[model samples]
Target chain A: MMVPVRCFTCGNVVGEHWEEFDERSNEGDEDPEAVLDELGVDRYCCRRMLVSHTDLVDVVSPYQ
Target chain B: MSEEYDVEFVEREDREARFLVRGVTPAFANGIRRAMVADVPTMAIDTVRFIENSSVMFDEQIALRLGLVPLTTPPEGEFVEDDTVTLSIDVEGPDTAYSGDLVSNDELVQPADENVPIIDLKDGQRLEAEADAVIERGKNHAKHQGGVGVGYRHLQRVEVVDDLPEFEEQESQIVRGVIEEDGELVSTTEFDHDLSKRYPGKEVRLEDVPNAFVFHVETDGSFTIEELVTRAADTIEARATELEDAVQL
Candidate 1:
């Protein structure tokens, strides 16, 4: 349920950048585009990995 | 006789690089690409044993995630292929278990990116695991692939043919990879991959440079770009030698 370790399309490691992307995009007002760009995540496939990830780990962990 | 090859780096970085190689056939160029993708060896979690599992996620799921986490591969001779490195993690509830938390027995081999989230433990849930990372070739499993993205294209040579017809709307001509103009290498990105933009109001002829190829390689942090490339070249050489010896015998 956690962020995937690699992009579904390109297999690039995007999990490592998830925490910073979430923190900056949610806490600060920085644009997600700029944040992804700054993180050197250029491919649309890799970008989708961060934008579309739903951290269901917290949601599912409470059940079991 | 050995053929002399010329190599020029179009762009170089820690994890990725683009280089132009001359004096090689398309098949030889493809061989280099294939070797980089499938022959290079790197460390990846091969077997994971769970000491405790109170989290919601299944042990298998957690193991898959751990296997995907890129680990820093030490230099050759430090560990041979199939050598195993031990790493264990223990995290209690009210917190998350990140890759950084994995305690590795080998200092030289650790997680390349620390922030990779393995799982999130709730208030009382716990996750403990001991994994054996084995050095293996990408041919065995994709998780061991050091070169995540490896590809090449023929080097294009652009020649200005003549001026475009007056008042003619110039259609967008897209050209990717690197191009050679006036004996200088230029990446297509420099002109936004649009040939019309680089040569305005003019017709241009694009031709492939015989025996020249441009390769773009990106690694998964298991190793440096230089190491990935050189190791790939070494693999090819070794294979060629083996073939020669077999034919003689």
Candidate 2:
């Protein structure tokens, strides 16, 4: 996953919540907002980090 | 400047707190903010050595993640910048790696929040690394910031010019100030910023208290909110002492 260690805009640590966010978002059982709120990420900037991230690590690792 | 100030707690949580400091200058309030953000020292992973990695994340990325993990600061006079606390993590998993996985040499110097995830590993994927925690100030790097969301706003003064029927209906909802039935405004009321927004364009006007400040501080679990504020005040005092020494010299 292309998760950043901290939110670029607000500097809140967001990477820690990415795994759970990714899992629930994929499950489609709960809205992203509810998941984010449960994760204690209330700011819009931190919220955007989880919503827009793509897992590119798997795609690029083979080249290394 | 010698006037005594009143500190009233507005809200208190484990990691966040809000308080009102009356009878302080704006400069003094700002000094607290700057000190909390830059002067207070905290423990953070500063260096990492990789032993094995079959995961998708690069070694540098893993190290960066480790460095960002907030560590609990050792008691005052217990931390030494040159002294490094070792942290090692080894996991073979079809599961997620967490900050709790990293074991520290010192019990007092470990991850402040254990739930921080480092990486997700699939079956057959392995990751191993050793990290060093060191004490540092936030001015050097954000990873060492003792606290976050350290800020203050001037306390506001609300006055009612003409209490109309519309204003009277919303008066009960306003906790900061009491709107008497005869439209008299009380100055001793508590201040709440939301009150102004709840009733916009009413006969009320909000004014700023130049000397009164409402401060909010949020920690990253590195230290208690009380510790952060106390350290900030200590930092300000140290700076002032240095300035006095310089003038004497």
Candidate 3:
């Protein structure tokens, strides 16, 4: 997964929430904003880190 | 006799807090800030050994991710520097790996926030690793930093001159202060640095109190902000006492 360790702007640790956020958003049970709010992520910088991540591990791992 | 110093709470919350300190020297104020940013110690993953890997995330990447996870710092006197806390992760593919998966050998030093995502595995992928946690100061690295946003500002007093032109049209664009009765601009009760930038040439003047400071602290869940501040104060006191003892010696 292409999870960032920290928010670029605020430097708050954010990579930990990517899995649950992805699962809930994909299941259509909740939107990204609601999921982030529930997770106690209140900053826009940290929120953007989750909403913009893409899992490129599958493609990159094959070359390794 | 030492001058009396007063601490007033401006705001308080679980992860963040702000307070005002009055009748203190600038050196003392900055000492607290330095102690908070560099002296206070926290638990962080210092080393990682991969046992198995079939996932796409590289070993180094996985290690880096694990190292950044904030581990709970035990209460005062409970932390031993260089002591090892082990964490192991074992997971199969077709799912996601999280900080919750990394179980700690010591219950007191587990991940502060459990829901952090470490990696995502496809149907056939798997990852296993063992991580060692160590107590370190923020001076050694940011990962060991107890507080994320530890800073302070001089308390400000703002006054608006009424002789200036009233730019009612630009009122909405003001970054700080609010329009009040008689079309006068009044500084907001909150201390904000952007007050002067609200209007380019407006008659708002701000004066900073030399001996009064407003401190703002935000923690990363490894420890309470209050605990961090208290510990920082203790660290400063210890250092000062050491200096005095050396002078006597």
Candidate 4:
């Protein structure tokens, strides 16, 4: 199903990458909270961190 | 301009006609960008001589849930004051239908036998009971899959229950209203998608309705019987004024 996700600040479309990455990395004991902490997003974020891996990867480009 | 009021329109989810209006006050930009929401006769929009004084702004949920009006201008073009508050009236009419008076305490009790007398209660009892019911409901609804806290959902609306099999024998028109801690009246308008046909301009959310919560009549509302009686009397006075104006000498 298409994921429902939007930027918290401006309500813009980020991507399905975060949600995909979350489901894949949710192995072991790592929850969304831990993932968000590792990614350094302040605050609790939303109840469900609705983003895909592609969205998070774009924050830092390849050449950077 | 002391008469110019900045207006802002805020739209929200699942509802229309309700909007937000923020105002400003005279305290910045050398009084150039100053707005007040004081009571003023708004005949025409003229700068320098006419500006809104005293304004009130509410959050989106509050505005939609309360069904406020959609203002076109931002009330913040001028510096806003602290005490400035707006009535947030949207529907066009003289009687600002405060969501509070929607479900008054004095229900039109079907006249029983002459021996049975009317019942009345002390003040504040109804408000307290209604608040308690709302709190209890908030707690129950909070137990969702995500464990959301007691948020805006806590403020429910008043409802109008249609004919049910149980109440078929004794029919009475029931109008409900929800009360929030911040003093917002919640109820459905006649503007909801399907419910708009019968109630063309009123809509109250399902959970926010105070009907099921009204277990007792003597004390489970926002106002006392005496206050409602006063309102009824006022309606009569208004009707009298209308008759006097229409009668030919």
Candidate 5:
């Protein structure tokens, strides 16, 4: 229901950088690629973890 | 075999570093790499007790998330394997719970990063829990791995051999790891890992510098690079001493 604490593939801690990534890329006008680059997320696997996360907790939590 | 071992840092940062270790056999280098990855202990949530949960996710799922959140590990001798630090979190609905919300009883063992989201609470939903983080080695659980990425390679030197023959097709010669050229160390990535790009229309010979290795290590923020390396080395030394004592008996 949240961004995983680590990248599923490489186990790098991507969760620590999620709020910055989201705020800069989604909420602000920065490109996702630039944001990830600035965050030092070099590997494609770790990049995908941040790019593809949906943050479904809000969608699913209402049902409970 | 009396050569003294030497170490030099190529790149150093809080969580990641690259360094050259000279006068070590391949086996010794590998031992250091393995020790860094699996021997050094870090604190991770090992037990969780929920006070209330109206969120959609199951308790087990949230617990797993909490377990993976990297916690700041105190220096060696501050904690033993079974020692646990208590942390608790409570958040009301219309808000998202994050690692920062987890209040630690021990200040030194707090979460490494505050932005790691644990869960999102919808309107009226709540998440409250207390977790016990225990010191453990990576061999016990992946969550306890402080050195998330630990690896090394033999230091290679590139020597110019000869110019390419007239009209000879120049093929891409890709090399990985750090390379020494003219008494200077350069990462292969500086030239895109292509020998051709570095020395166009020229032949180059690659030679491994005996007993030298370049190690690249990245941690999970639980500990600094210096602490991780020193702790890993200490672990190896301790094990060797234990073996020696056993043999003497």
Candidate 6:
């Protein structure tokens, strides 16, 4: 049997059938948004929703 | 003031090879480019190319796991003189990482380049068990286009003092290790560049390495964790067979 793999970021199933949850588990549970980062993909920004100071720093401003 | 902008990556109108980033002001875009440049670590001169040009794609979650500072958007740019984003990538610096728990070092995040587990020969298993740990490590390293880099071992052969004294004419093999001017394995042999002055008792000769000695992985002048382990195993096995063949009276 295949082990279910939750998205690294969202901790949610990578994908699933919407109504097949009666016997399976939680349904309509939206995977958390990927917390965008400076380096690369955020495969772990699930449900926690922690805002970051660096993420809000002078990113829009131009560096000298 | 904080400003958040949606980064739209678009291919350049002219340069097919290079893509252009739109929606972002030149200053913001240049700042992002500079940020990537800073990521080169000590290889500050090393260049980073955002192939997509318009939008940069990456898994930010891993970046956080690595404890790297984030520069999401809003006041993003080279502004906010108080705040700075430096490239925490270890390889960019003057030194490259090796196979060890070096990533946890406070100075930089240099994770082990390779993880080839060496099975203890004394474990009483004939032939040897599957190199599960290291075999898997090698496969992982082979995935990226980088595959792996073979760092030079720079092994030096030393002549045993007692043997040298007894048989001034006969040649024999001996173990060698790096020692400081004070005679210590504190650093790489290369650090003993001034061998003559530091090691007054004996000079460590760099040119005395053996040809059969597996100093590197293969063609590349670099060393890999797997290569090192394999070389060591082969050496031990060969020595054991040689000893078996020798009818020591």
Off by over 4 Å in 6: A1-64, B1-147, B158-192, B201-206, B212-249
Give the distance in Å from residue B159's predicted Cα in candidate 3 to where it truly belongs.
Answer: 3.1
Candidate 1 at B6: error in angstroms?
Answer: 0.8
**Individual DockQ of the candidates?**
0.75, 0.44, 0.46, 0.01, 0.72, 0.01
TM-score of 3: 0.79
Off by over 4 Å in 3: A8-10, A17-52, A61-64, B160-204
User: Tens-digit lDDT track for model 2 on B1-249?
Assistant: 578888877678988877888898888899899999889989999889899988888899888888888888988689767778999999896876788899999989888877777887877889988998889999998998987877887766666676556544554334442222232332333335245544454667667766877787888888899999998898788899999999994
Q: Give model 2's TM-score versus the native structure.
A: 0.85
Q: For model 4, what is the alpha-carbon lDDT of residue B241?
A: 89
Better of 4 and 5 by lDDT: 5
Better of 2 and 4 by lDDT: 2
CA lDDT for candidate 4: 0.25
lDDT of 4 by residue, B65-93 (tens): 22211111112222122222222222222
lDDT measured at residue A24 in model 2 versus the true structure, 0 to 100: 94
| Tens digits of per-residue lDDT for model 3, B1-249 | 198998877778987887788898888898999898888989999899988987777799888888888888998888679788899999898887888888888879888877777887887788998989999988898888887767787776656765346654323222332223242323354325254455445567556766877788888888887899999998888888999999994
Off by over 4 Å in 2: A58-64, B165-202
Model 6: per-residue Cα lDDT over A19-62, one tens digit each: 13212223245322321232122334422222211121124213
Model 2: lDDT of residue B15: 84
* Model 5 chain B weakest 10-residue run by lDDT: B1-10
- Say which docking band candidate 2 falls in: acceptable
Model 6, B1-249: lDDT tens digits are 034433221212210111222244444433333222221111000112222211111323222222211111111122322332233222221221112311221222122223211111111211100100101112122211011122222224333233223434432223333322222222233434444333344423444232111121111111232333334344345556889889676
Q: Which portions of model 4 show Cα errors greater than 4 Å?
A: A1-28, A33-64, B1-249
Which has the greatest DockQ?
A: 1
* Clash pairs for candidate 5: none
The deviation in Å at residue B146 for candidate 2 is: 1.7
Please state the Cα-based DockQ of model 1 relative to the true two-chain complex: 0.75
DockQ-superior candidate, 1 or 6: 1
Candidate 1 chain A has its poorest 10 consecutive residues by lDDT at: A55-64
Give every collision pair in model 3: A16-B116, A16-B117, B94-B122
- Please report, as a residue range, the 10-residue window in candidate 4 chain A with the lowest summed lDDT: A7-16
| Model 5 local distance difference test score | 0.90
